[model samples]
Target: MNQLRDPCRSAGRTERGRTRARNEDAFLDCPQHGCWAVADGMGGHRAGDVASQWVISSLAALPRQSNFDQRLKAVRHCLRILDSRLGRALPLNASAPYAIMGSTVVALLLEGNRAACIWAGDSRCYLWRGQRLYQLSRDHSLQQQLMDTQRLTRQQAQSHPAARSLTRALGGRQPLMLEVLELCTRPGDVFLLCSDGLYQGLGLDALGRALSRGAPGQVVDRLFTEVLRGPAADDLTAVVVQP
Candidate 1:
């Protein structure tokens, strides 16, 4: 079976914290299939949870294969499938439109020592290697747009009201603007995929410190502690991938 030859192995864990009314985040770790992902959903209603589940399940259903191109193609295909379903599930002018029901997806597919990443919206993917952290994906959010046009300062954008407002996401009417990243993976390298809730409260410097000090699990716990020290406003989720 293809699964037996899978070169990647991973562990995924999640927690529902003290504040949010619902857990609208999802994650997956299928090391045998070389897939790992984190999705953060938006919507006041149950639509957020629904959107997140759809993304995770769709990605999980993709075939396990050795070819990188084929694996990436499957990832895009899964996203399209989610997009179509979301469109049918949430019409534009419905009485209770699920328009707000969208999600940011960050995923990595590892084959041997090479990794491919795909992202939509603001949920981020960071690569930590040799004590340096590199943000592998750009946020597709309103704050990012403002920054691009020089309309908002970086510090201001961090606290901007629309910082959480995503410009692109899965299940929206517009086509997804997916970013693909390819990088070499090392034995001691770490990859962090997390929701805005994790980043909003913990600055990059703090995050770097945590990553430098502990294992993947410990880093996640420290991050959660930092987040809880601040005002709790949204659901938080984090997935650390290390090999």
Candidate 2:
């Protein structure tokens, strides 16, 4: 197997339009090993910001390892530990109001010339090679479930009332079903991990065009502007990694 290679990376974040109380999104930068991540918190009645912060901090603090499998295992272990901590800290009480507190995570790890990515919830990871764009993560949202049952079209799901309702997330009652992807790396490849807030306004075509035409910073700035045009429903976070 080919090894992963280090890549230059950049990241950015913003809060949504309507919600002023909290910005519940997080991201990390690990340039030394070409690792980057973006996490979006479940926003409602609970402290979603806290959940996002804990998950991001745990992933960022993972010890560096030489082996790919070891590194991946460490990442998974860290997430599990965070889940347990959150469960202990914020137990749900049926007698009380809804206490939903969890986060969506998407991360990219580069080793030698190969790359692996893991994701949970709706936060997304995408790969851009040449002119083609590939989405690496699957959403754990209710709209996705509807699509699976042929009850909603992709376009309808985008604006569904329950679009934000996630089926899985870190800190939830059940263990998160993490999605992982492995890909070959090349020098000009660009990987993006971002919250739904960033992509809800702009489609893949617009994102791909922006990435192809500008630097990472410029792309993020433009994307933020586009998202701000819509109702600010949640926090927005993005991480752009290029190799």
Candidate 3:
């Protein structure tokens, strides 16, 4: 086996926000494993915080792999196992959103110069390069569906009452089908993995400026500062990574 050390640094933060009684969000910031993630537990569901914590802990517990593909497969398989367990344990009903537990996840895996973003639901992965911000993950939500299939503008799609409704997530009704995007890393690339609350509160301009700082800790601090500056009605989590 060819073992190579992952050369990356990361920092993370999570908040329950002003209105939420408990934080149902979790994060993993392990640069040694070259794995970082943000998981947002489904709001209005029972044991939301526990669901998110399970995701973070499961990923953190994965054995180190010699290569990116091995690590990526481990992540997918781990999540799939958890999803099946949650489905049988919770038996969620679409009509009763609060009766079961689930979560949305966005994970970033790095090895050498290669990186992959794997995600489900609305949690997002973003890249900051050449002074521009690019969202790497497309949300699996009704809002995104409207924009994609109906060709509606972002504003138009968001106007719908179910715009924020998740179309896919861990422990959802359907089998897990995680979306993955792989890319070659650049010398100055900055990546941000965050829950919906973080991005929904801050604009792209603010996020780009924060990531432009080029240090994981500083970028995470800036993000938290910006998001908490206004009304924060939901739990928020963020993991910032730089290589």
Give the residue spans of candidate 1 off by over 4 A: 1-9, 94-100, 158-160
lDDT of each residue in 184-207, candidate 1, tens digit only: 888778888888877777888877
Local error of candidate 2 at residue 42 (angstroms) = 0.6
Query: How many clashes in each structure?
Result: 0, 14, 0
Q: List the candidates' TM-scores in order.
A: 0.88, 0.89, 0.95
Using lDDT, give the best candidate's number. Answer: 3
* Ranked by lDDT, top first: 3, 1, 2
lDDT of each: 0.78, 0.77, 0.89
TM-score winner among the candidates? 3
Residues 26-106, model 2: lDDT tens digits:
888776756788888777747888888888888878878768778888887787777667766766577854565678888
Off by over 4 Å in 2: 1-7, 16-18, 156-160
Alpha carbon deviation, residue 127, candidate 2 (Å): 1.2
lDDT of 2: 0.77
